[model samples]
Target chain A: MFLIVGIFIIIGLGFNLLGAFSLYRFPDVYTRLHGATKCTTFGTLFTMFAVVAYSLGRLVSTGEARFAVFIIHGAVAALVLLITNATGAHAIARAAHRSGTLPARAVVDRLEEKEEAKGGTPR
Target chain B: MTIYIFLFAAALVGLLAVAVLGRLVAGPTIADRAVALDTMNTLVVGLMMILAAVYDSVVMVDIAIVYAGLSFVGTMFIARFIEGEV
Candidate 1:
């Protein structure tokens, strides 16, 4: 159990570090968003799972009711992360693009083209 | 054994946050900085959970949950603010 928890923590931290590195290295805001959101979300999932596993292990060994509470709440928090992170990423990316921050190496922008077709803006 | 692991992991996370801080400081655009802030919130919640575990406190876990909920709303607000919808 300890070994498994350790591995999960290591993986979570690895992904987080990678995400931070990508945040520094990525060429544009979109790519930075891609790295930061995805890696941190997934990494957080691993860390929360390890916490859940540890709580469960304690619940089994000591039969403590509070450990169960910890497990449930940890799971809830992880679920929140899973759901909200993606939607937040979408919101941020749209906000960035709509505010006119285009990607650095874009061949085309379908959203822009559609907006142009709709006569939203003359440019 | 377990305490050490949690402590080590927390330290690594702190360093990771510091790395993200570079972008938060240096990002040219508001949206870029917003993204970094969002990432940091998610990570801080994770750190809170780990702290809860280390201390054997159910109360801390509940706090983490509340923090996550609030941060989600804050992220949306920042997005809308940047988009001129707020």
Candidate 2:
């Protein structure tokens, strides 16, 4: 039980750390959003999984109902994180684009091109 | 032993959140700062969930859920502000 829980925690911390580092490593907003959003979401998912696993192990060993409550609540928090993180990222990206922040060193900007094709001025 | 692991993980995650703050302070553009803030919010949620396990409190997990929802709304408002819609 300790090994399973430990592995999940380590994996989560690793990814979370990577996400933080990416904020400094990426040069622009869009790229940073890509790294920070995806990595942190994945890391948090693993952390939640670890918590659920721990609760399940305890529930099985001690037959406690509180551990079941822990499991369900932890799962709900994870679901909320998963859904909100993605939507927030999309909102941020769209806002950034509309607010006149262009991607740094891009080969092609399909969104800008598409907007131009529709006769809308690219910001 | 198990408690030590949870505590250590929580501490490390908190450290990562602080590290992300560097970008929040130094980001050259509003969009960059917004992205950093969003990342920090996610980290905080993760930290709350871990702390819930450390303290053996289901109520902490419930708080995490509420915090996540509130932060999402805050992020949306920031996004709208950036778009000049508000």
Indicate which candidate wins on lDDT. 2
Q: Write one digit per residue (lDDT tens) for candidate 1, span A47-76.
A: 888889888888999997988888888888
* Runs off by more than 4 Å, candidate 2: A118-123
Q: What are the models' TM-scores?
A: 0.96, 0.96
Identify the CAPRI category of the predicted complex in candidate 2: high
Worst lDDT 10-window in candidate 1 chain A: A114-123
Which TM-score value belongs to model 2? 0.96
Tell me the lDDT of model 1 at A43. 90
What TM-score, to 2 decimal places, does chain A of model 1 have?
0.94
lDDT of 1 by residue, B1-86 (tens): 88789888888887777778888999999999998998999889889988888888989988988988898899999999998987
lDDT of each: 0.88, 0.92
Candidate 2's displacement at residue B10, Å, is 0.6
Q: What DockQ does model 2 achieve?
A: 0.90
Q: Which regions of candidate 1 are displaced past 4 Å?
A: none
